[model samples]
Target: MFDKNHPHLFGRLITFIFAFWLIIGIALFSLNDTPAEINQAKAQTINNVGAYFWAGNVKDLGGGFIKTGETLLEGLGSSIIRISMSPRFRIDYNLGGGCISNFSLETLAKGPDLNPILTNPSFSTIIITAYDGTSFSDCETKNYLYPDLYTPEITAAIEQEYKALAQYLGTIKGKTFIILNWEGDNDIYCGTAYGATANSCPNYQKHIEGFTKWINARTKGIKSAGVGNVYSGVEFNIVRYLKNAGLPSILYDVIPNVAADYFSYSSYESINELYSGDNGTKLLSDITTAKSAISAGGGNNSNFIIGEYGFETLGREDSKNKLETVTNLLHSRGVRYAIVWNLLDSGGGFGLYDSNAVLTPSGKYVCSLYQGSACFIIQSPSSTPTPAITQTPKPTTTTVPTNNPCAPTSGFASSCIEDGTKIITVAPPNISNSNLNLTISIDIPANKNSVIWPTGYYWSATLKNWAPFTLQGNNYPGSSWLVNSASTTLSVPYSNLQPGINYIVTWDYIWDGSKWLGPPCSTLTNSLCWRLETFIRP
Candidate 1:
């Protein structure tokens, strides 16, 4: 209530005003720093699904098939799922339903023990048939002892085996990957042991056809997933090696045709000899080629999985060293998945943990790389028609790049932008966030039209959404967030802004949401990088 003319009153008023401004200034500075968004080009590309990583192969313990299902998703995040539907066929004999049998793992290796994995929630994605003969294949080699495959005894057995696999998998109530595979049937040392010459080899097409038919019967038809079952039977390439073993044309010639049916291959080398470990050479190099060659030979529906591929350190001290190199190679070559091939030493020296139950150094080594984008199936648009012939991507975990969280080894590496984050920037020469607010710029890409800045991300536990504050746009569109229009710039109010904590990407462009969507790059017209994520801090 002081007089208006008082000198002291004026001073007090000025001081009060300054103090208020100072408080606000401090709060504004402390609002927290948000990371700069990554500048990206206009996105118009569409993709199908998330890429899968791999870890696979295990021997059965007293755990049975259901236990194996729990173990598959539990032990290896993206590794091979245990397949146990094949039955001893005898023409017209249908297996499964009431049929039950037992099996055990003879080849034990070091790795994450499935005891805990079996309890994981993701186990729902696993299909468990009664575990049976997954041991190293035993081929009959007895000369002049070949039986006609079309006969009921054999045909029925094969069909029953397929039916069992299909029936068990058909019961899956979650996101499961079916493994329609067979191993003991492949040409192995047992073929020679039984004295069956190559010329007298039994019919290979019948067995594979039966398997495919069973899968189709279960899945409704030859779908992309069913056709892509090459990885399940990856270890049976024993056929390829048979030619060098002096087998007959009937045996060798059938390889390229049916080898991919189960994603076939076989390897008994220790990790040490596998990689040589000389300079930087890996042991799995040759093995990678064998698998790739087979996958390419098979048709589109051919799946590429390595159901069995591992070595024992007991034989070679360097066995563990070759693991990384081989894993890296497989990932790089687009062999979508693989299993470590072990359980109780039920069969070999490959168990990640000791029979006594402890993680081996090699077991730990393979597990470390099992996570993340090991094999990214990158699509390269060919000049072909509707369904583009995209090459399968290879391993993308080697040599991680700086500042990127979704590390890319090769193929299409991941973006640094998190999901649901908004962008804020201007247009013209400043189409990129690099030049903001001012109008001085040039060289705008054709993809970009109307450049609108993003309001950025703010957190509110109550909202639970990324940015939980009021929004308002001037030239942009998003104001209260709820108000969204593609054509306008968006302005979102933030409760706070922290730098490097949010996985945000800020790219500049000129797009009116409705029509123009680009910062046109000649090399990226039809291509798109829709989203990305990074390791930022909160």
Candidate 2:
């Protein structure tokens, strides 16, 4: 009896020991991950996250030296960093020791702790400027025009510099995407004035002619480099086209005329004016319009990018919201890449972090996207002293039915409608950007009979046959319906719906004997007709 009991107890002890060891191993593996492993894990979680942070106050954080640029990169978990270089400005372009070229790629790459940025496998995208001009004040006389300023000799220098840079980048390990682009819409095109009319700008025609030559030279330099991973692109503030319609726009005039690899939109137009008020309708339309223009200009839609998007915190209190709106729209739209305007706040509150290096709401939100949760990770000390944390009042909350179909989900803002009810209003879809660039029309078949309702009714649609349908509350307020056609077309911008989700659009009509009117079909009877269309917004 003693021998038998001893064998049983030994077996039980062995089993328990094995289980304990397995648990310990898991904890150790998770906790002891190397910095590279941790960074790789973080990189796998997000995509196309990047920003442009240059020129800010410095901070001394003891032994580990950190600049605002470094902090910005770490905080945002940036996979891409846009670095500008002024090759001509560099006193020592080859050996790289100079004061005038502080922001050049060579300078930044060789700076303290920044070499890792170039060598590290984490950063997937790097946009480098081939040539950056501080100001083209002499353009009034055409002396600063394209061939004049960027003569063959200058273009060749640009090419050789870029080729060397490309060769160096190629020697580095890991597959990295590199774009050699140049100054976007600047005084070269718009002159010294910000909102100058196209015609009124000094030598506008000559400037465009000069720019066309300048961009082509830049593009040729980049292409001539022959780096497999490197491509040339042109960046333009898209608003230049919208504000000056019928005039030669960047997409219309230059892009089609050049052989650049991609067109980067410095998307201030959408962020400041077009995207707001509409549920991303105008923004989507504008992008579509821009893509069409690019296609006409000999570029494909896939190569389009939002190169720079940001809002200044100087006077705009809703800067955070505005930033999030554009970011979310781009993500949802599946645009290849987007870079925020800046990282540090110098004078303009454009930086995600203030001059003190403290996290701003916009910065925090960006960090959350990278980390997959709430996070604020500072790699080094900022130059400016950090301020004391303040507690602000929480946003007010309004209660709505959990089952409400029109209720917003994650990544969306609050809606005007609070009460849970059936659809009540409809409008002819005139999905137009503020200035008009794109349009989408949804047609309701004419054969379907009207379901008349006097109180109110809304055109509704369900998500993959979910119990409730999601509708925009503000889409209907007054009577706006078209009855004079075989199929009444309604406008529903793809921006209204979330990405990766299946949506079904259902429509109903109310007739007053004279004309079919009222919006949003209500579920009054079982006999009502339903049209099912599956839409996945990118």
Candidate 3:
């Protein structure tokens, strides 16, 4: 009101608004192609979003952990941040190591134990996969351990916690995802607690399949335990378990497991203690071994994640460095997420948060996961090209006599000539960064008044078709243009295109010009087009 009262300020404000609008312009996403009922759509991912919490290896990495943890979490940038925490007793990363015993994820996520924790924004995909103090409950449903599929107590716990997590997520759609990490028994040899049991293998899968369906059917916003961000006590173990159970990629349903799109493995600096090394037969190269298997399977099969990879605090500086190196390496290769261990007070020197609640170097490493958005390439605009126009002759205005023969090679209208393989010449072969660059050369005789080139040619990215060169070069004296080819070299600014985009129509030949000399390549138009009869690949 006061600014308006002064009058001049109001005038200045109006001018400023006008100037701002002129300079800023409008964004495409916000545009409305409003035709009363139509509106533009934006893309969104519906299945799952995963992030890893880096905690494990606090004490062992040594001092000044608080700052590091903060840095690490902040680094997650745009990824759905996460925390695969455990009760202090079993999996505290601060000092004590992760689970020594196992329990169902349902038991861990149940009521009374949530509330305060769910409130933390630092958590998105929360899974309490603890394996200490408790053993896999064999007690079955109705009344027996490992009965129908799950143990009774185990089923109850999973049901209870699942309901709680679902209800909590219901309040905030898209903001967070609460995942239940199913437990695996310490079958040290095969590395799966279920130890090849039908229930643990085939039956266990069926149980999970039905369970997720049942849960999804019951709730509205609640997502099933999509089995995401799985941390391994070992990576190979997951593969080994799958192979042992005869579970194919389809069964892993990795492609369909929208909720659990990533496979995790556990690799501690303690790899030697848990896995058999080369001394035996096959060398257990930790994550390197696991990653290779996943890659060889298929690119679309599943994205690998080094979910729980941390070393003990007692680990030497050399060991600690190795751990960090391994973590970064896996992360680079589409291992979607990587989480250390829980931040604990004591036991294993491997917590991200130390005994004093400080974040270790590993903590800083983890915080990096939470901090910023992932690097996105500025590629879309440069790759997509505007389609070039090629003239299509509509059989001219007059009709030809039914008994008439093909047009003579010596005259104007030559459309009747057999469209035999016409060789088009290309210029500037080597393209930078794989951009489509091309120029076509077609044969044309010169000097008899003028020469004409063909209009209309096909271009195929898959088949690699060359466009007809329609432009008539060296005809400098007059603006009377003859041949025109539907060809151009686009400077696509990016790396190698994926499978579907390997080949492209480097040239499209077509002409609408009236200068139709003749198709006889040996005569008048020969010099113009003949110069381009052959082309060599770069």
Candidate 4:
């Protein structure tokens, strides 16, 4: 017992005892930890991510078409997931080509419903676009608008299904929210196609009435579930609301009529209004105006959310910077969530990643945010080399007769003028609130036949669509003001303007004889040949 190995036995026993106590101490310390503290240890951060109409192709499983939602949810790294399903899930309405028709909705409504997304523990927020009819052409031709799919049976089915969904959402641990919405303003409820003027798009009046009832039914259904975790929302393209001052605007027309819990803005125009390296001036102004509009329409502005925002063909570097800038500004404005347009490139070029699985600069930044890692800095592009100047003989310009009241003036109306035989200006010089009090000025040379007064068409660069207007008291399209008159000014009070975005108003005039009496500006691409005025709302 006095051997060297035998003498160390007591010391070895003490060392073993110390290791056991150390393990026990660590376990006891963990007992007092919060979920957040444990998540911090695992480096889990909050992620609000969504896709645009993409849940991958569903597989035909004979009984019904279904997909293992987990496969796609695994690497998404999102705390919120957005998916879409066609309204014609139970029965085909023959809604035509552009409409999204599949069994995804039925599968969600029946067995294994909501489980596709809820089973994935990583996601706490779920947004479902229950109606995916996004065809403007179909709206014109077949009247394939949101109202077309609504019926007594469909409404009941929607209510029953969402009730089940809400009940399930209530059982999820921690804070969870589910939002249900439809196609939004993507369908052309108001525009030139239906000859929509400021007062009416008469042909689609039934559609609007039907839509209001349909939306109310949907919200009622969601509320019937009696769960606080579920909310009803309506998506509106704020840009469209601003551009088209005519009928069928969800923000102005439908929202006030429905009982939606939140307003989601598909904000494409907001992205277009941003300048490089913006310090949140334009973006914040747009959001503020949008909130005011929502509030005025009786919607809860505090619940405003960005349903969609993205950039395509802006190059990955610029897109990344723009997206990051927008997100930071939205966060500053106290927005709870925002969904990028899509995850994978599906030809619109709005995807975070390309078809080949290559991560775009924007995608990389988003991924970093999801993973709680610092984003890689995208270097600004180098300035292009300026071309050397070359001297050439100057061509002589002929002097034209003057009396152009539409001449460019200083300050707010600096860029309001367009000159020719007939001159035009959208607003008189140096005046604010020009958009609200829209003014169009024109002058014609003396000793000419009486000129046709101009009719206004509002152009939305984002939608590449024109909203044609009829002069007050006129029911026909292409209605003009002060016909067979010259050298006059016309002012109309327009109250539906959304400020902080540039608007292009093209006034068509048949000059003493302007170029070949071209088709209406809405149908033609040569917008420059027409008398146009562009201005930003102050």
TM-score of each: 0.39, 0.53, 0.36, 0.49
Best by TM-score: 2
- In model 3, which regions exceed 4 Å deviation? 1-113, 125-164, 182-236, 240-262, 268-303, 313-316, 345-347, 365-538
**lDDT digits (tens) for residues 48-84 of candidate 1:** 1111112223333224333433432333333334433
The list of candidate 2 runs beyond 4 A from truth reads: 1-46, 58-66, 87-116, 132-144, 175-177, 180-183, 190-194, 239-245, 274-278, 313-317, 372-538
> What would the per-residue lDDT of candidate 4 be over residues 1-538, giving only the tens digit for each residue?
0010112223334334434544676421133331233223234333444544353233221222223233223334556666654544323212234433332343444445345555556666767666423222222233334576566776676566556666766666564564645445544345332223545545456666666766776688678988777788887765443346545566667888888888887765455544322234555767787788788888889988788776653355655655665665566565657887666554456656554334567767676666411121122111211011011111122221135423321111211222334344455323335434454444433453222323444443434444444332211111122332333233323333333333333332333332223113322344322344444445
lDDT of 2 by residue, 17-52 (tens): 434644676311123322223233333434665777
**Model 3 residue 191 lDDT?**
31
Position 68, candidate 4: lDDT: 26
Candidate 4, pairs of clashing residues: none
Predicted candidate 3 versus true structure: per-residue lDDT over 379-491, tens digit per residue: 11111222211221122224332343333222122323235433333464455655544454544322223233223232332334333323433221111123232233434
Runs off by more than 4 Å, candidate 1: 1-76, 83-146, 152-157, 176-235, 245-252, 255-262, 269-298, 314-317, 370-538
- Model 1 scores a C-alpha lDDT of 0.32
Error of 1 at 193 (Å): 8.9
